[model samples]
Target: MRTIVAQDVVSASKFNRFHLLVFLWCFYAIGFDGFDIAMYGVGLPWMMEEWNLSALQAGAVGSYSLFGMMVGALVLAPVADKFGRKNVIIICMFLFSAFTLAAGLSPNITMFTIMRFIAAIGMGGLMPNCISLMTEYSPKKQRALLVGAIYIGYALGGILASLIGMYLVPQTDWRVLYYIGAIPLLTIPFFIKQFPESLSYYLARQQVGKVVEILNKVKPDGNFSEKDDYQLHTALKDGKGFPVKKLFTNKRAFTTIAFWIAIFCTMMMAYGLNTWLPKIMQSSGFSLTSSLSFNIMLCVGQIAGTLIGGYLAGKIGYRKVLVSLYLMGVVTFIALSITTNVALVYFLIFLGGASTVGAMNLGNPYITEFYPREIRATGMGYAQAIGRIGSILAPTLIAMLLVTGIDPKMAFATFAVPSILAVLGYLLVQEKYGSFDKVVEENGMNEEFIEGENKRIIQS
Candidate 1:
């Protein structure tokens, strides 16, 4: 009996129903993640009015959820590495949904803020694990596109939140939005039934039975047997030294630090804009309806940007693409500061969304490519957690500046500075570590295995 490496089986398989199923579920999970996060921003204007919140108070409320997400990303995400991706994701889905529902029922701002924080723990855990599972299941050639496609759900979620707010919030209470967030819980039963554990996780555990079972589904034609052994083509084996510690060893220290910096700056800008864009537009003389419309436009641009950015990164290189996006983002922010025309403001906001939110999401595939499977979740989780520092600060900082009587354009320009720093971070990474593809190739299995499998399938 011949031994088949798990990854080879996945890479060699044709795009089929199984891959589509995985994509759909991952997309569903991530879409809700975005919806839950964006709901606060969509409802913020109403909450401020109803509660009589000062800018600082509202900003602090926004930070509560982000801080919870930081805890979840840093603390809860690593558990997926030890337990299983499917289990952790299911738990997280339940955690966020239940608490978000509770948030709607809170009587006071303190209670509401507490619920949001608790719910965010689950929100934070879902993203990295979802990204990791998607990466594990995807073919190397299509990895970037798959990651990007799944995250389009995130943009869709944001759009949905904006739409709900626009239509429902005016006619009803803001709590209705939180009630809608609870809808994701209905999908939990289906997820329990359909979602598969990562094959790499199983293979890492040396669980031959589970590996063969999933591989059979992944490549239905393959007659995988119990006697057939499995391998991973990776240098580090499962249960190696502290997963987090490994990140700093083998010359990964600098790349790891650089990537963290990139995530931090990009996330600061992304979250800042996400939390405050509507308010900023409103302050700039746009009506509430027009401001929310800008939020929708921002998400529309993000959807387009993710697809386009992923395609461009595949062709030119991830580093070049990110650096260019960040530079373009800086220019767009400056344009936004000076523009008074409503139409121009909409255009600039769309571009800003593309450069900020879209660019930030593009980092997921790059991070997955950089780390080994053994610690991929940990590496990603830590990066996300550190980035949350910026997320945590974004809303509060913008609020403070605005409340202090600073020009809204200057406030936005302050946010733009992070994009320049992000560009520098990417350049430093390229200088130190080389291209994203090169790093992935160094860590990945031999190309011949992929080619040979394709040839064998064709011959069969």
Candidate 2:
């Protein structure tokens, strides 16, 4: 009997109900992740008024969630690789849902901040795991597009939160937003019932039985049996040990570091804008409802960007698409700094969201292709963890700058720096590693390309 590699089965299978279920479930989970993360900003105006918070104090409160996300990404995401992606996702979902509800009930800034931080831990862990699971299940040709599709949930979540703030916040209170945020808890039971474990994860563990079980569902026609042997088409070693060390080894050091830089820069801009865009617009004389509507427009642009970026990535390739997006981000931010017309400002905000948030979403599929199954979640986790450091600084830095009397226009222009740096970081990444179809055809998986490319880099 011939050896059956799990990925080949997945790659060759037609899109089926199993794939749709997995995609929809991940989409639902990440939507809530976006909602929880963006809620702080949506409610910040109200919180500031209700609590008499200084700009710095409000920014600090937002930073707590980013800090928690950093810790969660660094500490908890790697555990998914060790245990299972499905399990980590479930735990993360429960944590964020329950704590977001708790956050709404807080009587003081300290307690509210603490609850937000705790909720963020779950949000952080949930995102990368969803990306990893989606990546593993998707066919090579559709991987980036599928991952991007799942990420549309994030933008949708942001839009939903902004809409709630616009219609409900004025009628009720800021706490009502948090109450709506808790609705994700209901999906946990559905996830427990429906979510499938990553076939690659099981294959990495040499769990032949489980791999067979999943492959059957993934491609019911495969009719996989325990009598068949299995293999993964990657060059990385598999063993019973921590995979974090592997990120720095196998000539991955530079690629990993460069990837982290791109992640950090992109995330800084993303969190910074998401956390402050509404407030910044309000300061510019927009009504509170109108400012929140700007957030909705921003998220709507993110949805457009993710879909368009995914399509372009599939056509032009990931590196070119990402580089172009970051470059466009530079232009959009600069334009946003100077634009005065309300219609133009909204259009600029939409473009800025597309470039920043859309580019950030693109990073997941791009990075997913770089690492092997053994460390995919870990590599993504560490990259996101480092990025969270930027996320942590973004809102606070913007707040401090405004509080110190810097013009909001100049503050917006400052965003151009990270956009420029992100371009550089993307440039530094080995393009051969990112060419999904070519690598998949030539080496069966991109990790083999990374391993071989690293060898040449070391030798030269």
Candidate 3:
């Protein structure tokens, strides 16, 4: 595992065939991840129409999926730590893909909802592990950039969903779309064989020989500066026992709770807005095209925002940047709710997308920073799993409000409170321990902690 961790510093130019292949595999995983995420969003309208579901029922469907995702995030993340990231990835992909494909074959609303719920579990579980895996193998200098790039696959998938809706939905049924989305699963088998085990995981377990073997496969030419001097250590800092328990007991407990709150709030706002934007717009006297295009505008903004946020995160501290970004989301969401002008709405959408989307990206990296390597995945999973609660509840809450005849603008505007609150949460995070890279610094406390444990920390 130390050897795998040692290989973490390879220059981009040194990334040979195996690197390229792994990047593509991760990319493909992300693409499919995107597809599955958007599937319910795209199908919601049609499903509502066919089943004569009220706004509340439609919202419930979304909530169900989010609830399932929360379960997966909470449950699978720690399992990844206890088991292995690669195995978790494979199992999750299978679970999600199979359920998603089955969603296409559902004979009734109940059955369809069940399938979506199951698939959401797979969707939630895969994200952190993928982020962790990619980061584990990527070069250190390019860690943020690579993570950002991997996230682009998610945006690309959203765009693909929009494109499919634009071109295919009018001509074909939504079920066909589900079938097309499921097609990406074919890559899972390929990845299982080809995807490398996280070296950091091996090293943490003191399996030095296995780490060396895996490193050799990635660098056949033997160019990595394999040195015993380059000791690998876990970034975890809590007590030596089960890391999950330490999350609440250690110095990081306060910060961890803060992050989870921020995640919950932001996700509630994000999912709520994404789910209800069209309805809100229609209430504001917009046509279907204009309302639908609102989402496209948001996606464009998300892509642009992620890029800008990634750059800023590199320049400033991750904590500072994330706080500012969440604040931006708070302000923009309120602006979006009040603005009547289409152009201003689009502008706010872009800016909000930029800031809030980046906040979403911060979860994995932030988790990587907060916990030691020994329990990194566990920490991330717990955060994400808990965070999924906000996402799961958003839709149902919004639906209930809509049923109550709450003003559309006012309904969505309520979400802005959370974004602002998230800024507060981020500020509470200790700047000294707010980034994963801090653990990599010379003579850092995390290093000492890892040495005592004699384990390698895997980060992605």
lDDT of 1 by residue, 165-270 (tens): 8998899999998998888788899899988997767776677798888878887877886787565444236545677887787678888888889899988988
Clashing pairs in 3: 1-203, 74-385, 135-460, 204-456, 235-372, 235-373, 236-372, 236-373, 305-354
User: RMSD, each candidate, Å?
Assistant: 3.7, 4.4, 4.6
Give the clash count for model 3: 9
Query: In model 2, how large is the Cα lDDT of residue 149?
Result: 88
Model 1 lDDT, residue 307, Cα: 89
Model 3 TM-score? 0.87
Cα lDDT tens digits, model 2, 289-321, are 999999999998898889999999888878898
What is the alpha-carbon lDDT of model 1 when measured against the actual structure? 0.82
Report residue 403 deviation for candidate 3 (angstroms). Answer: 2.5
Which parts of model 3 are misplaced by more than 4 Å?
1-20, 204-209, 216-240, 433-435, 438-460
Q: Which stretches of candidate 2 lie over 4 Å from their true place?
A: 232-237, 433-460
lDDT of 3 by residue, 401-426 (tens): 77787667767577678888888877
Best by lDDT: 2
